[model samples]
Each structure stands twice: as C-alpha cells, then as structure tokens.
Target: MTMELGLLKALLNKDFYEKNRGLRCPPEIFSKDVRKIKDCLDLAMEKYKADLTTEDLQAVFHATNKTMTTATKVSYDDLFRKMQSTKAIHGEIAEDALSSLFQQYVGEQVAQMGFSFVNGEEESLEPLRRLLDDYKNDFTPSIRVDWDDISIETLMAANKQESQWKFNIPSLRKKIEGVSGGHLIMVGARPNTGKTSFHASLIAGPDGFAHQGAKCIVLCNEESYERVGARYLSAATNMTMDEVHSNVSLAAERYDTVKQNVRIKDSTNKNLSWVEAVVKHEKPDIVILDMGDKFSSKTSDKTDVYLKDASIYARNIAKQYKCAVIWMSQLSAAAEGKVFLDQSMMEGSKTGKAAESDLMVLISKNPQVEGADEQDTQRHLNIAKNKLKGGWHGVLHCDLDGDRSLYTS
Candidate 1:
C-alpha cells in the first residue's frame, strides 16, 4: 500500500522525526504532487519548537502559497484529508518505510548512472564508489524482544512436578522430581539390563503412573505385546508367575485396578509417524516405545542423522500430544560392566538422541567376576542427563525384581 500518508503521520511523533530527520531527506523523495506538502511539513518541523501537527502544516502550506486558485486549494485540501485519515506507522514499520524509500532512491540513482555510462556521459566507476561509501553505514537493525517471565510464581507453576505423574521408583523420584506431560524421557541400557522392566515398573507397578491415573500406551517393537503385557501384569500385581498361579484371585484384583488405564500395542516395524498417529487417536497421557531406534528406517545418510530425526519426531509427538514419551534404547557394549554410564554410551546413536531427552537414565549393574554365578539384583540408575527439577545429574541405587518387572529404592 502507499506509505506516503503513513510516513508523514509517523513524522508527527517527536522521537521518530528526530531519529529519521537526520537523513536530511529532500522533497524529491515524495511524489511530485506530495513534494509541496512534504516541504510544508519540513517548514513546520523547523518553525514549531514543541511538536508539529497536521493543522500547523496546513497553515504553513496555505501561508506559503497565498496566490493559489480555488481549484488548486480544493485539491490540496483533499490531499490533506487523505493524509489525516491515514494512521501513523511508527517504530519498526516507520523504519521499514524509510528503508524502502532509501533503497528505491539508491536503485534509481544507480539506474541513472548506468544510463549515463551507456550514453558515454560517464567515464569511470567513481560515482558508484561514492554512492556505496556514502550509504554503506546507513542501514542498521535494532531488535528488542520481550522475554518470558522469570517470576517465582510462573517458574513454580511451569517446573512443578508435584501435580505431575510421579515416578513409582522412590530414589528416582527424589532426584528427577517426576515427569509432567509433554516430556520426552530417554531410558538406555544394555541387553538384559531390565530396560523393559524399568518402564513396566514405573508404569504398572503399585502406585505406578497407570495407578496414578495416567492413561499409558506401550508400543513394543523389540518384544511382542503379549510379552510386554505379561510384564505389566507382573508389575501391577507385584507377583512372579509362580506366585500369581498360586493366588490368581489376589493378582487379578491388583492387576484389574490399573489394567483399564494401561494399553499395550504390538507396533513392530512402525516408525515415529505411526506412533504419532496412535497417540493422536488414543490421546493417551503416556507412550512407551520399546527399542526406540527401530522406529526409524535405515537411510542413505549416517545413522545419527535419521536417528536424530526420529528423536526429534518423538519429542514433537510428546509436546504435541501433551503426553510423556518413554523411549527405551540399548546402550553400547562400551557401557557394559560399568557401574556408571553416560549418554555417550547409547548404542548406534550419538548426542542427537541424548540431546532430545529430558531425562536420560542408563541402567548399570555389577560386573561378573567370571567364577561367581550369582545373579546381581543390584542396579545403578545412571542419571546421565537431567533437564528436570534442579537439573542435577548423578547415580541412584535401586533393586530390580525382573520376574515381577519391578524396581525399588
């Protein structure tokens, strides 16, 4: 749209006029008809020590042209009416108008220079050099952003995990303060490190997320839904198969409590997009991806690139669905036999996967001494990365009952 009127109205503001008037813009910048009005404003700006107004400019215009005919006066009055109706474009918008005008002027000057050269009226490139030198430092960007609130009230509300879904594991809860909706938690471990059981414990064990009223969906690719569901059953009932068979009624009752809220899906060969679709359709409060790496199809690029894309997708799903996505991954062999683990030990992956995680817990256990055949129940939850409560990072000890898919502090 035509910014002529807007520019004039913007100049009425003292600060804008002072900042921009240093350009020493001539009447040539305005259209032929509006040049007269611009000249009058320039006169009024100098004459009025306080502030210039449309009425003041009108008085200046009429006073300067006392011998104008009636028709000419009417045309000028219509132009003033147009300018008056136009709302002032101040701040960034006014700056943009001025910049655009300056650019337009520069373009016309360059074009005239080229025309002069073509007609053999110019000799060297000195005119262009002078033009660039004169206007080189004229353009500048002044950006100001109103940041987000840092008030105690807002921080407490935003970082509050008290009202969120609490972790069933006591030791973990004290460290991470539990997880809220729209959180992407990455859990990595080597094979047979109770990776599946860890999620099962947090989600199906007593006072677990499901019992706490979080609608959860487990999409397993590494294992069958029936197998994963069985783990959930054991976790919910806090019983081994032998114990459950001996007391089916008690196990059934306990499992029945959290069964309705918990859902298990056999999502073999499914990608992150499929997971998103299921989450969007079911609208669950929590989603679990068994072996999250399998969700991404192998591509021509490096493993990290596609895995990074997958992790990004998973995070986006959690945020968009407003639910927590628990991504189970396998840690590399380098992390094996180590009591402490970091995000770097994630198998077939790099920082891209870890970077997307809110809380990264890599499971570790006591190394085998070769001769001893005792099963180690002790597990160390390596808090490799924590972007939650207080942002603390450390390890916490917990015992795992693999048979029942449970973890306890």
Candidate 2:
C-alpha cells in the first residue's frame, strides 16, 4: 500500500515552491525554491528503506502529474525510493525530465523574448507541422536547405542519364535547361513574347525537359482555362500552327500521358495563397507562379514589404514541400536594357525577392539597331545570378511569336 500522505506532501510542496518562485519546479528540483530531485529521493529512501531501480525513476519521471498526464501505481514516495537506488541513471533521467519540464514551463516566456531553436538539436521541424499536434505531442521547425545541400552525388545523378540520349532529345535553350530546384525564374518580355508558347512547348514537347518525368503545376493568372488549354493542345497534336487554334479539342486525347499527371490552373488568385494551398496538396515536382505582381499583399505598397511577403510565402511553401518554383516577374522600364541592382526591371518590391531568390534570370528584347527590320527583334535571356554556382552569369535566347505564347531558344 502507498502512503497517500507522502504523495499529498509532494503535491503541496510543488505548489508552495511554484508560488514563491514565480515558476514551476523542474523535475530536477534544483531551482532556488526547491531542493534537487536527488535530495528528495535520498530523504524518501531513508524514510521508506526501499531501493528504487533505474526503470523506477523513468516510470516515476513519466508518472508525475507535474510532467506527465497519466497517474502511476507508485506513490510519490516510491518514486523517491526508486530514484535513490540508481543515482547515475536517475540523475541522467532527471536531467532530461528537468530540461523538458523547464521548457514546457518557460517556453512561452522564452518565445516572448524572441529566442529561436538551436540547429541540429530537437528543434528542427516545419511550421505547419507544429500547429496540429498536442503536448501529448510536440513539434519542431526545420531550416531551409540552400544550394549547398545539393551533394555532388545528386548532381552526378541528375547528369549521368542525359549526355548520351538520342532522337535529338528535343533540347530546350540552355537557359531553361540550367534551372534547378529552389530557384526563382523571371521570364518577361514585351507583349506577344512567346512566354505562353515556350511554356506549352516545355509541358508538351521534349524542350520541356526541365519538367520531364516531373509533376508540374502551372498557375496561369493572366489566361483562362480554355485559352491555356488550347496552347497545351497545340504542343501535343503535332498540328500545324494554324490548325491548333481552329481545332483544339482534337489534341485532348494525347493528354492521356499527362492528363492525370500535369496539373494546370487558369484562374486569377491575386494573393497567391491559392497557389500555396495547391502546392501543399499536390506536392508537384515544379510549380510555376505565372506572374509576380498579382500576388502582392494589400497592406503593403513598398516593394520591400510586397516582395518580402511574396518571398516568404513562396520560399516557405517551396522549401516545406521540397519542390521547384518557377516564378515569373515583370521588369521596370530601365530594367529593360541592363540588369540593375535591387531595382532593375522589377516594378516594385524587388529587393526582398532578389535577396531571397536562389537564382535570378533577366529577360529583355535584344537591342535593335535603328534600321533593323521587324523580324530582327530578337530576345535575350541573361543569367543575372546563379546563386547555386556562387553568382555566375550566362545568356540564352527568347522569342515571342504573335498571339501564340511559344517561347523558344
């Protein structure tokens, strides 16, 4: 039989200690107001003449209402007696219990002070994962992985199967091929620049190698479902350019290869929250945010706040899901010629987006001489910064065909 009086004393003592100290007593019981748990165990051992096992300490540590939810068969005194039997293991157990208890009691206060988690410790977890669990459960936040996390082995694997393929392999321009995970690709051009056509070619033909065997989600903020559908139809049908717009329904059958696979949406979601939800649900291999300006928050007018939120929103979703996001951003007037720092072509809030982006590509119409013919208006894709390669730069080609948004090298 257990002494209910001893258990009562322990409970009463706990109350008294917390009252005076303005804090709950940790399991270690070493706080200024309370004696260490080891001392309590010693006193209980002398009083009960019973030896406790290591398992007994573990059981007691978990059993205490102070730390755990469930009650145990052993009285509070039995916990003391058992802990005294194995000082070393009990001490270690007490330490863990104490740390956990301390955290539970003080975590809220600590968070108010703006303390973050220690990396490589138990704190690493995703933010959304924490909200759903109970303290009967716990969660941690995971850090975002940068380009450095890509091991040489993974790079080698991404390259090994390619180099030797046949059938023209339907290669895209070097610019598109160079994009990888965790990048923010801004492909912009004057009206009719083949942005849509290029993207369709990627999704339907071999040029879309970046998306091959990869699950992709395209968010078409500017176009409706029917308009975008027709483009996709053209890419799959091998139909002449004129025939595609005329008979789009004919190409619907070929989508069987990608019908169930390729996820496309042609709706206007200005805030981009809808995109976030889709990313969470589908876990697509690549996500394309058609345009950047439409996603800005209403409360913000400054580019910093706007892009900052956009970056936070996009990066968080991308990192959490471990997928690539191809975000299209518009450039400003001066930005049309050269890639400027912080403010070049991005209409507003570029600093935040540029800072958070793993990579930035600048697209502009190739400079034309005064008398050049209309056909001479070529486009240029400049590698503004390839953060993964430590800020390297390169160039590619872009061309916008009339009415059809077919982007080509």
Candidate 3:
C-alpha cells in the first residue's frame, strides 16, 4: 500500500512548495485550507520515523486543529486515494505547472527591469535577452513546410471565405485593405492634430470596427479614463461634449451601447510587462496603445534601443495573440506646420517603421494657420509605408470636427 501521508508530505517539500505556491491540490487532502495543509506537512516532516500510521496522523491533525475555533475536517482515507490518483497523473500536471512557472518568472523579471529603468537606473538588457533566448530555444516550433494536410480543394474553399478586416473609416479603409492578423499599424502626427480623436473614432464612430464585433481595449497613458470616455461618447453619438453632458437620458443610452464592445484601461503604469499581462488575460481583438514614446520599457534610457525593443515587443504581442495593434506615435518637431509627412518624421527610431509596422500613416494638419475655418482645417492621412498590398502610397483627406470629435471624408 502507498504511504499517503509520506507522499503528500514529500510533494510539499520546501523547495517545491516555494517554487509552486499555488500548486493545485485536492481540497479533501487539507479540508480546503492551504494553511492547514502546510501545517500537516510540517508535522509529518518533524515526526517521521520510517512510516506514519492513521492514528498518528490523526493526532497531528487534532493537535493542529485544537487552537482553531473550528476544526479542519478532512477524510484521511479519501484523501489518500485522491492523492494516489493524482500521483498517477503527475506527468501532465507537472508539464503545465512548469510552463506556468516559466511565464510567471519572465513576467516578474520584465516588470522589475521596467521599474528599475523608470527609476533612472542604468540597465543593460543583454542578460534578459539571453535568458529569454535560452528558454525559446528549448522547444522547436512546429512549422508547416510540407502540405500533407492541405488539399487543393480545401485551399479553394478557404479563398472563397477570405475577407479583409477594416476600420469603419471609408476613405482610409479603401486606401489600405483593413488591418489583418499579426498587423502592427502605426499612426504618427504632430501635437494637437486629432490623433487621439482618430483612434477614438475607430472604436466609437457609427461605422467603427466595434460595430463589426471587434472587441477593443484602449490603453490610455496620456489622458484620464473620464476624458477618453467623453471623447468616445461624443464621437459615437455624433453629439458635442456639451450636448452629451446636458442630455442625461441620451448620454446614458449611447454609453450603454459603447460599453458593450470596448474596454478602456488607465495605463498610467506605462510598462510593457503590464501591457503583456493585460493582453494575455483579456485577449482583446484590438489593442490601442495611445502614444508610443510614453510606453515604459526595460532599456528606456537609450531611446533608439528602447524604441526598437518596444516595437518588436508590440509586434510579438500582435502575432502571439493574433490581434491587431494600433500604436499611435508622436511626430518630430520638424513635421510641424507642414501639409505632408514622411517616414523621416517618426520621432524615436526608424526601426519602428522598418521592423514593427505593417502599415505606417502620418496625419498632417496645419493647426497654426491664421484664421483657418473649422471646415478648412483639413487633416491628411498619408500612407507613408504600406507592406500589406505593395506599391500603394497616397493620402486621404478628412474634415475634422473638434466639437464632436468626428472626422468625415
């Protein structure tokens, strides 16, 4: 017969327990109290003399439970069988446990590095990269080099069902066939040129992607949740902020419709690790990082290196999660007062353009022009780089309505 207490106590060995604190154990083994399980294991370790009888284990449990107002009621025999069965299937559980532990380790390390950088410490990411590389090399990724599973008939069927995913904006969508899987779309603009409004319109406007059943999560680091929400409401309802604030009944109705499809997070933490955690948990179809430069990274002191790493990380998130990421970036000061923008105007690094994005769009508007009418304040969406459908370069003109936060073609 298997020694149930001995095996249970061995499984809770100090090193194993420390590494896997949340390891799943049957409730009948410890009466659903983790503390009680630990106490029992401690007693077993102290009093072991080759083997423990049922009476001896019962004595330990009774002694430990005496101090508590309520005793821990566990069926010792039932627990023994459950634990034996668990041991039999330990291989599968152990594999999953190890994977979870590795992911947690990576998250904790990255989060610490981000905090250290944000605190103005000089840090090198070489060690972190090596560690991740080692972990990645352990498993060989399965690639479909041979078409043993696919047939010509199946390929034809799939082609018939294929469709491009697009934003609700007609002109922009027409210029570029909508965003697709693993796509990193970058939008850059000079200050106060309705970049935020443009992103908001994608989620809130009547024709927005959210209406097409796209679940979106917005990470707003530069603005408050209330402010973003206000803008979204105004754009979604085609009403001015003042109108929404004044009409309670209409505002509530519109908000109810908006909240169903989108989640807005206050990303003041500004750390990529936090972003990774949110993306992993929420698994949103669309992730909007409000501004690029504000995002915190492990090598934040080096602007070029940080931008490169951050862009790579963003692209990885899009691909790993099979979601489209819209990264809003700031333009260089040289882009100001210009009617057109190019790839050179991107603020931080060209690697962001070259390595990260599938599409790069620059929004240009002459905000400082004297006495320009609201209708004349035209914003141009310039397709600076298009990787999806090659050889497509052009600009789409949009009329900005600042009051309602709407952009119309």
Best by the lDDT measure: 1
Query: Lowest lDDT 10-mer window, candidate 1?
Result: 135-144
Candidate 2 lDDT over 346-407, as tens digits, reads 56654677667766666566554688666643556566655553344666554544344444
lDDT of 3 by residue, 1-409 (tens): 1333333444444444433333233222332443354467556645563344444555676667665443225444355445445432233354354444346555666788778778867378776677577555433322335555478898676444222456677787676657765788899998889988988887788778677677889999888988887888888888898898789788778766767888998888677778888999998888899876677475867677788888888889888997888899889898988877888788877665556788888999854657755445588998888877544788888878877778888
The CA-based lDDT of model 1 is what? Answer: 0.85
Q: TM-score, each model? A: 0.75, 0.60, 0.61
When 2 and 3 are scored with TM-score, the better candidate is 3
The local distance difference test score of model 2 is 0.52
Question: Rank by lDDT, descending?
Answer: 1, 3, 2
lDDT for 385 in candidate 1 is 86
**CA RMSD for every model?**
4.8, 12.2, 15.2
Candidate 1 root-mean-square deviation in Å? 4.8
- Candidate 1, 165-283: lDDT as tens digits: 98888888887768877888999988988999999999999889999999999999998888898889999998998899999999999999789998888888888878888999999
